[model samples]
Target: MSNDNCTSNVSQSIIGVLDVIAPQIAKANGLLFWGVILVGVVVGIGTYAPRYRRHPLIGILFVAATTHFLPIISSVAASVTSTELLIHTILINDGLNSRVYCTQYAHIFLIFVWAGLVMMVAVNASVIVVGDARERRNIGPLKAVTGAVVWTTYLTISTLVDLYREKVATIQFIEQRTVANVTVLGQLFLIMYTKLIFKYYAFYKAKHSFAHGRSPSLVDGYMDQLQQLGDNSDTPTILKQGEYTEYDARLHPPALIVMGEDNAQVDNQPYGNRLKWIPGQGDKVLTLDRVWKLDDMDMLQSPSAQPKYLVFSFTLFKLLRCRFAKYTISSASFTKTQKFFRYTLIKGSGAAGERAFRIVVDELSFLHDYYNSSKPIYYSHHGFVIFNIILSLYTIGYCIYLMVIYIVLMAMGYHHSQIYCSDECLGEIFEADFAGKYSDYVQRPPSPVPCDTHADLIDGSKCTSYTILTWHIATTVFEVQQNQQQHDKCPHNVAATHLSRYCAYLVACYPELLTDNNDEWCKRLYEDAKKEAARVLSTPRGATATYPLIVDLLSTQSTHSVLKDGASLGKQLVDSGMGWEPLARFWSEMILYVAPSENLEAQAEAVARGGELITLIWAMLSHAGIDRK
Candidate 1:
């Protein structure tokens, strides 16, 4: 009886041991195999992290490190760790058989994806910190920090949702699902709130600045003032620190002289506050918000207190001086021509902004009396300089810190082992363990086409056809150009066809145009002179250091007035229907012909609208000019 009982007990013990050890052994083997590979990839990536910014190779290293190592580690962890440990410690799994174990692979992918996202965020934050400090000196550090916090919070929440759903399987688990969903939703809400706050605040600040004739914000104001100072013309001639000079009450009476040296003495008659008055010179009145400087002789000229006002006035003064200088420097042949033009225009003109600019009127008065005798010494000026230096260093340090923290966190969150190399494998791995729908969202599209060849231009004939098509389509107010027989739906213009046709026409019309010596032919086809002149005119007024043509045009008072007014008039004309149409059509055709189809849509629409508007203007002009010729 005892022998039989012993044999039965021994067999049962062996079977029970095998049953318990089999799954555990299988999990252990899987973990060990993946763990080594993950470690190798992570170490390789980390070694090359510092070089990421300099070369594309480093970027590859970083991507591989985060994507591959994280997944491998995650996979190993899921395989090795018990379900209870995963649920309690890692916040993953449900007590739902082997399915829970299989779903745990998502946790591995979650970790790596999160690693990539965090790294990107960190890189962006570092860039912002460094860039803002250098470029936006007036904006306080608080602004940048606030933006970073808002952005980081959003990213963190997004990552958490990804982690919960993919890695932990919390999306399917009732106990953890509610918390996961709430975190995901809360993150989204916070992003929206932050965006709204930033947008409205920016708008308010801009409006406030515009109304006050100051910059919209403190930073903007400072930048504007600095720009003004940099561009101030009068300040440069009179004093070294003309922009910094303090202007006070004791100043000159207006209308001391008109032009040239002031040799004539006027009787001290009572004007405003017992100031002497000159007959031809207009009265000088102080205006608020205008910048002025007290000269060495301690007489006021431009405006006082506000530095930007002074700079702006000085710029205007310089412009006038430049005009006079141009006249003096004119060639003998040109001088007679300019003088004749100026004399005739001046005969009928009213008092100009320049002609009335007479304060003490002499070179000595301008040198001594217009500029401030003493300059301001503000503590703030020094403080600002010091602050800028400190801020620059601090910004650099902070960026480095951000970069390091990001890399470390990314390394911690994701390792190279996490990413799936094959789409088929990924789909199978995820779907086999979880629902098929879980894999759908993670699916990636194929790589895009690589750019290689340069584009060829359309020939004159093709170009002409394209021009005609544009003109024809534009006549319909951008309504989809319909076929004559069937107007039921908007027809696709397929502008590419027109472009091809035009290109063919250009080739046929001037076959030699394709040759290297075809510059003459190209010149005939393209209105190069007009294009160049328009380009010159359209360039921003103050951006260039020198504008010889602008200076020449401004030499005469009437011409100067005309040029200034012309800019405004041109802007108005271009904004109206006549200007908009041609511009729209040209841009549309250029885009449709030159750019990818996806990018051509907006350009085509613009072209069609512009052509239509231009045609209407042309028709109207034709009717007015020739009476329906």
Candidate 2:
């Protein structure tokens, strides 16, 4: 009895202290929860033969999510506690109207905050709570089990204190939050359901499709009409037929862009101003038909020509894609593009004609679950989707509740304090790389370049993080320089912009996928770039992290850094007068070029976290038997 009394006193003391700072805690929780949503939804799955959750951020964020998010339940519930305190301190002499608004109108925002916790879990559970056995082994389930217990305990404590009715004013709201979390789990289970249903059929289909000459024929009908536009003598003039016009990609490939004489047709389209069709590097091969090297930048300024458009790496190992138009597609869509490229192979060289293309999911968890069948991967819960579907339906009610309340609150003009802490309002606080790191998010304007940067300064000739950083900076500058009116005409601006940032994020945050080099090289170079900024901008070394300050301090002397080369590239791109077309194609190819990795272990790890586009491209290329080895 004495021990129980002692425990009760201790608990009350903690609550007394919590009551003091709980309001501020609620505000912070609201902000962080939204940030997690912004990063997760905006950057869904995307990767390779690179690595699994190698970057510290993946593990760091996962542990942080489990530990930090548990208390959010109590903090959210504490909103009611806050209101009671408000009533006693400020509304003591006020009437029923004031007390009602304090209890009802003010605390309605708590619903949104509760939803935020559920969302945080939804975003993380796929990565943290549930993963392949290998990932589970590494991450361990103890953290998750502990977190769930803490979350429930917090809720239970609140209910116990306020008798379930006044525990933040209602019990159903808590129930709603729980249902929202479970619904997310159910939806995730549904995904796993489909994965379990089909095996590696896509891989086999892709290989057989290529071997049998059933290439990417989807665009054949659409492209034939476009090819006819180039039938006249005008077509020959526009096509750059050099001495060494063509070489089999199996032996040699070009990395330059070519434009037409009459730039009107190509210019109007998304890929018109972009592509690197390496100037005839003396690459020699007999013409299969009307083979023309598209490497001249001069074509953009030139006159009209037809669109016999097909952009692909004409080689065996680099079998990435061949697309028709400007649509960002699904996994199925990416596969279709690769299938189409086989036609180009058949036309380009008979020697390479018999080979098939290959692509895989190329991440660790995916491989373990599907490709890496060395161990028995139990499909123990594969049949759980039925139960999950029912739970998923319950989520609809919570959504309606949030929406209705949002409308009511917005109309009431009750938006203030925590209500104003929206993703947009708190958006700039997130780094541009974080925004770009997850390709799903709409691209925020990238970090302002302090000054012009240089490519020569970074080791971009090889697939290094420095290359990504330099190009990312250049891409950002070029994107910022675009004319607002042209945003729609070049539908690919968003693609290029997002890809550039995504690559930057990969290099800066996730480096193992891009290079076999040790991470120290990337960090050393990154620190060097910062030091260069400090030197050129004349800022203290300690303050280098301050982006705006560094930009303000930028000077002509900063010409030796990545910022200088990037600026040079951006200026060249701007002067080239092509819209985002070239950049779109450039990134399209750049991403694929880096997709082939010798590091299979790293790739498995990448899949375990969240996949990358490069990984998918690598996997697809794998189907074609295009490998680094």
Q: Which ten residues in a row have the lowest lDDT in candidate 2?
A: 428-437
Q: RMSD, model 1, all Cα superposed?
A: 24.3
* TM-score for each predicted model, relative to the true structure: 0.22, 0.34
| 418-511: candidate 1 lDDT, tens digit per residue | 2111111112221211111111111124334232111112223344322332222232222212232243432133443343334333332322
Q: For residues 449-533, could you state the per-residue lDDT of candidate 2 as single tens digits?
A: 2332222122357445666666666676566556433455355887877777666656555567775467667656655665675
Mark the regions of model 1 whose C-alpha exceeds 4 Å error after superposition. Answer: 1-196, 208-310, 313-402, 409-415, 419-629
TM-score of 2: 0.34
Q: Candidate 1, after superposition: displacement of residue 566 in Å?
A: 29
Model 2 ranges with Cα > 4 A deviation: 1-53, 57-62, 72-125, 128-157, 160-390, 405-597, 603-629
Worst 10 residues of 1 by lDDT: 370-379
Per-residue lDDT, model 2, residue 296, is 29
